[model samples]
Target: MINLQWQSFSKEECAKKLRTDIAKGLSQQQAASRLRTAGPNELAKPKKKKLLVRFFAQFCDFLVIMLLTAAGISFAVSFYRHSSDYIDSIIILAIVIINAIIGVVQESRAENAIEALQKLSSPCARVVRGGKEYAVPAEKLVPGDIVILKTGNLVPADIRLTESSSLQVEESALTGESIPSSKKAETVFPPATPFSDCRNMLFS
Candidate 1:
């Protein structure tokens, strides 16, 4: 696949370089072929750690290990002296257990928050294929697919517009600008243009 400087290319040039028809888009068979070649358009989630593993990981801290060692030594000394009192060793072990539980709970909550954000960002896109528009999962989108963006719709993938009318995309996530950036399909940019200045393009 070619690494295109998409912003530098004209709308027609992009369509040509992608081997797609701007008007008709890719045929069903062509889209399927491309999908197999390009794979799904989604971020790969990190492999999740098992709950037991996560719980045990909390004890990997140096301080926790040292405390555990101290508790074990204290219990041994009490046994050697023929003393029945084990309160100090027991208290230390209890504190260590509580701390581990707290750490696990916090880590689980953070994982849940990240998962929620991913779910929120995953969106369907309206795409043109075989001269007809269809609402499709963003992950199913292949390169050269023509996408239609409406107000309030998330940009599903990085795309160069073939048409636009009063298009303003909120790119604060990427550019850190509070205001929506105006987009024009006819606008052409030079090579090496800053991403924030590529008014003709939309990024996911």
Candidate 2:
């Protein structure tokens, strides 16, 4: 399906651009072809770092490198002085190790939390295909599908509104505004309009 500045177009213009019938949506054959071309409607997950790699990354900070350098110099000085005490170098090394451990632990916990949230999110969306309404898996959605939005429904993709009735969407996840933004299918925004001001559109 066509991908363009949908927020700047009227509903009729959007339908024409996407090559979709607003009343009937896309045929099964068309949807299938578009799905293959677009791939699944999901964000790419970052590759997880190994625990050892993450631990080492913590030492890459400037302050950590400085502390390590200071510890090395202190050890060298102690060795030259023929002194048995290595307290200063040992303490600095211990602090750096502890900091790395804490950093690794926090990163691991955050990854687990994000995975749990992904599992809990909505997996399907209601859409019209071949003039028939179906609750299809969200990953199957293509650009031209006519999605039916309702209260509390998590939008499955970035969509242009074709119709609405007192629609007010919670966009805090995108705009950081707690207030629900009022939406209108007929409102065409100007070029370069901020996403937060695009009342005629919905985002995933």
Candidate 3:
């Protein structure tokens, strides 16, 4: 439990403090109280998007559409000209189709990559709220709550250790270590640093 007698701090303030103090030994109750808490401890959700809408957004490319229109004009001119123009019209149409196909393929693949990246960040969390267990959406998680983590669950957010009995965490996602890490509460810094040693004190 977090002995969070945080007399002066509001929940948001307290959560902010906890995020800043992830490695700085805060008690379980203190940390728990801040878990999935509101205030400064949250990242707001983005507006939900429909896949068809997103795909349509890609169609707005002026260059691709322009090429297609030009090709259509080319076909119209050839048909009005003479039967001998068939080869020229076909070539123009092929160019337009190829350009459109390339644009659609690349843009669609890029969107998929972005979606896959989002999956990497969406992790499941086990939390204790009001002395009861709750499985919640990670985006809805706030600070000032007690979170229980174990093998097979992704670390939804950053955490400070309130209690640990040989807390071993697999940090290969962040640290590039095939071997898992053992966690303990302590101060750490430069969070984005690629140096594995700096990440020793905390888990995701």
Candidate 4:
């Protein structure tokens, strides 16, 4: 694991420890090698269930199981009493199957809509490599890479501040605060300080 104590180190110290130039950032070749070793910088998405599996899961509910048992018993009793009574048992079984299918379809549609919304909210970033800046998807980021943050830009990854000029970050997603908090580059807090109070770090 890349356990960097970013808070305990100064800007120069961080550059030395990370073995990268602060102004020029990592060279293209170096960044590529690190990326291959560390893998993409992204959150793991939940695996979606297969459609058939999800549909069958609806029939596993307690009520559905009990209804199936009752239907079987009714059919056995009806067949012994009179031929017309057997039709009633068939009707009951049909209704249960129809209800289960409807429930599965409705829930599947809701899950698909949520996934579509998440795709729209994916974030991108601007980074400096070999002293040249480029716009790339946030997942392409790697450790020791220099990211340029501006107002209204989402933080692409957990980052340490090397330079800041009137930097203010909106951290409501992490801290639940309503206002954007001011940031500093030189302040080092105690190890036990709450995450919301760390003015020098930004998290994705």
**Top TM-score: which candidate number?**
4
Against the reference, the lDDT scores of all candidates come to 0.92, 0.91, 0.57, 0.83
lDDT of 2 by residue, 135-202 (tens): 99898998889999888888888999999999999999889989999999989998688888999999
TM-score of 3: 0.48
Better of 2 and 4 by lDDT: 2
lDDT of 3 by residue, 43-97 (tens): 5657655655655565467875776677668777877776456666577667665
Writing each residue's lDDT as its tens digit, candidate 1 over 1-204 gives 447789898999899889999999999899999999999998786898998898899999999999999999999999999999999999999999999999999999999998899778779999999999999889999999999888898899988999999999999987998999999999999989998999999999
Candidate with better TM-score, 2 vs 4: 4
lDDT: which candidate is best? 1
True-structure RMSD, every candidate: 3.2, 3.6, 8.7, 2.8
Candidate 1 vs candidate 4, TM-score winner: 4
For candidate 4, the per-residue lDDT at 154 reads: 85
Better of 1 and 3 by lDDT: 1
Residue 200: error of model 4 in Å? 0.7
Order of quality (lDDT): 1, 2, 4, 3
For model 4 the local lDDT of residue 120 reads 82
**What residue runs in model 3 are displaced by over 4 Å at the alpha carbon?**
1-86, 98-123, 186-195, 198-203
The positional error of residue 138 in candidate 1, measured at the CA in angstroms, is: 1.3
Q: What is the alpha-carbon RMSD of candidate 1 to the true structure? A: 3.2
